[model samples]
Target: MLLTERLMAGERVFSAWSSVPDSLNAEGLAATPFDAVCLDMQHGAHHEDSVMRCLGPIIASGKPGLVRVPVDRFDMAARALDFGAQAVIAPMVNSVADARAFAQSMKYPPVGKRSWGPHLAMGRSGFSGPQSAWLDEANRKTLAFAMIETREALDAVDEILAVAGIDGVFVGPSDFSIALTDGKAVDPSLESMMEAIAHISARAQAVGKHAGIYVVDPKLVQRYSAMGYRLFALGNEQNYMERGAAALLADAGALTS
Candidate 1:
């Protein structure tokens, strides 16, 4: 099923966050148990060429490919879709206008101004029948998620969610923490931040939209799950490798000792 369909069906989807721009790294993550895979371009090393190259392996792995485009990079969002990404997450969407611009780059005319060019998307989605059929399903199949990381964004969450072609909202908890604390700290698990996080989730749910979050710690998954966040972008490729190596070394040391 498409990522949008799964979220709409109320399923909790965990996606692996890929920071490395290598297609091999993306392929490795896509082959894992993650329901989806996202290429991080905002803070990661993913450039336009890499995003285009990396998404192919992800799609070939039979998992949905997603992209977290850099802040205000609406054009990359559309390009990612054309490159076969099922969804695009726009970071730092702080107002209704930001949401509208991001949405405009994601969907076609009437809904938005996204030009027709699903070069890789058509084959990846197995739509070899007709162009009209693809066009008809494109808007619903592709998802656009606006990141709510600032006070301005949190305040305008309702209005952003109401915007057409905006399928959902994603919380950048790390940045949100800084914004919440007025640049004093970068703690995502602050007790004070819980209310705001819960409020975001509640608001999205109230309007029948999907809610997502970037989870730094895996243990907090269940806590956020209870707060109504169905989509989660977990740690990146480096974190996974470091954690796996640590666990393996620890087991070997214990056995040798």
Candidate 2:
């Protein structure tokens, strides 16, 4: 099912968003936990080949997956979707036009003019099966998440939300912090940013759309949930892995009495 479908049903989706460029670990991680995986093709070491490699495992894992491409480029968007990603989360979506284009590039034919072909939507071209038809339904099934990452995006969140056909908005706090600080860390400025995000959530709820967010501080997850955040990318794979390993080692050292 498309992410939008699940979100519309009022399911609080938990996704793992990451910048791990290695396909092996990415696929393994996707298969392990998470309702979906948003491969970090943006600001990560992943190239087109890497994206393909990472996605290969995700498809085989029986998990729904999405990718965050570097920019709003249609080719990148089209390819990411072609690779069987249930969705594509675009970065720096700050306007209604950008959101429209993001949605336009994601669909096919009347939905969007994406060059049609069977690459990974099915195992092969001209290969039609009940499951294969599932891929064809992608035009209707695929999702498009426009990231709310900048101050500009916050300002236009309501207008952007008014755009029809957009599945949801993903909040990128790091970049959002940058936008708030003009390039600094998240702090007091975050209060207003949080308010802006909350406002977006309310608007989404009003219009029956979805609102996704990245949760860095685990403490904030439930708080945001109370404010109506539906899709939560709890944290990147690297964040948890690093913290877990470090904590284990620290505990081991402390036991050396």
Candidate 3:
């Protein structure tokens, strides 16, 4: 099922965040149990070429591929879709205008102004049908998630969610915590930060829109789920490797000792 469909069905889904710019690494991530794989271009090392290249493995692995485009890179938003990303998460969308620009880049005409050039998308999805068929389903199938990371964005959450073609909102908790503390520190678990996150989720839920978040601690998954966050980006390639290696070394040490 598409990530959008799963979320719309009220199923909690987790996506493995990919920071490395290698297709092999992406394939490794896709083969895991995560429901989806999101290539991060905001702080990660993924460039346009790497995103295009890595998506091939993600598609072959039969997992939905998503892209977190760089801050304010609306052009990359459309390109990521064209390159076969099922969804594009735009970072730092602080107002209605930012949300509208993101939506314009994500959806086709009438909804937005995204030009028609989903050649790779069609092939990746294996839809060898009429263009109209694909066009008809594109808007619904392709999701656009606006990031709510700043005070301005959190304040305008309702208005941003009201914008057409915006399928959901993603909470960048670390940045949000920093913003909340006036650049003092990054802490996703602050009581005030959690309260704000709950508000964002409640607003999205009231509108029947989806809500996603980056979960730094696995133990907090249930808590975030309770707050109505159906989608989660949990850990990156490095985290996986470190955890796996630590487990293997611990087992070896036990055996030897």
Candidate 4:
């Protein structure tokens, strides 16, 4: 099923994404956690080959597999789908035009301009013949998510959500912190920022679309979820590993002593 469907079904998704270069670790990490795991090709060192490997366990886990392409390029998005990525989170989409281009690239001609072929998605080397009929279904099944990071995007939240094929909007406040936060933990600016995010999220809900956020700490993560964030990217991959490893060691040491 599409990740959006899972989210709309009221699934509180926990996506364990891989930040390191190794796809095996990415795949392994996804197999053990939440509903789905994203192989982060945008910020991580995970190349095409490694990413394919990382997807192994995620798909094996019976959970959906997601790929966060590093940039806003159609080629990257297209490549991700070719590798059997069930969905893609395109980083830094700031406008309605940008969203439309992404949708076109993601879908077939009628719905999108994505070139027809079953690269790795269907175990085919490539397009050996014309496949006009199947492209729409293929495009319809895959998901597209836009990152809401820029102040400009904040103003265009409603329009972005209104884009026909866009599945979800993820608030990336760490990168666009000012618009989403006034100061630090208790900054007054946070109230307005929070309100804005809540507004966008609410608008999304009103339209039957998903609202989401990428938060660093556990408290904030849960906080946003409680406020109705259905699809949340918990945090960066490195932080997850470091804290987990340290906690494991500390626990082991305490147990031994």
Q: What's the best-to-worst order under lDDT?
A: 3, 1, 2, 4
Q: Candidates ranked by TM-score, best first?
A: 3, 1, 2, 4
Q: For model 3, state the Cα shift of residue 195 in Å.
A: 0.9
The lDDT per prediction is 0.92, 0.76, 0.94, 0.72
Q: Which lDDT tens digits does candidate 3 get at residues 63-98? A: 999999999999999999999999999999999999
Put down candidate 1 lDDT per residue, 100-190, tens digits, no spaces: 9999999998899999989688887667888988888899999999999999999999999999999899999999999999999999777
lDDT of 4 by residue, 168-209 (tens): 788766656654444344332254577677776787788887
Residue 115, candidate 1: Cα error in Å is 0.2
TM-scores of the candidates are 0.97, 0.86, 0.97, 0.84
lDDT of 2 at 239: 84
Off by over 4 Å in 4: 123-136, 179-192, 253-257
Summarize candidate 2's per-residue lDDT along 201-242 as a digit string, tens digits.
888788766778878787887878888998887677678788
Question: C-alpha displacement of 216 in model 3, angstroms?
Answer: 0.5
Poorest stretch of ten by lDDT in candidate 1: 248-257
TM-score of candidate 1 to 2 decimals: 0.97
RMSD of each: 1.4, 3.1, 1.5, 3.9
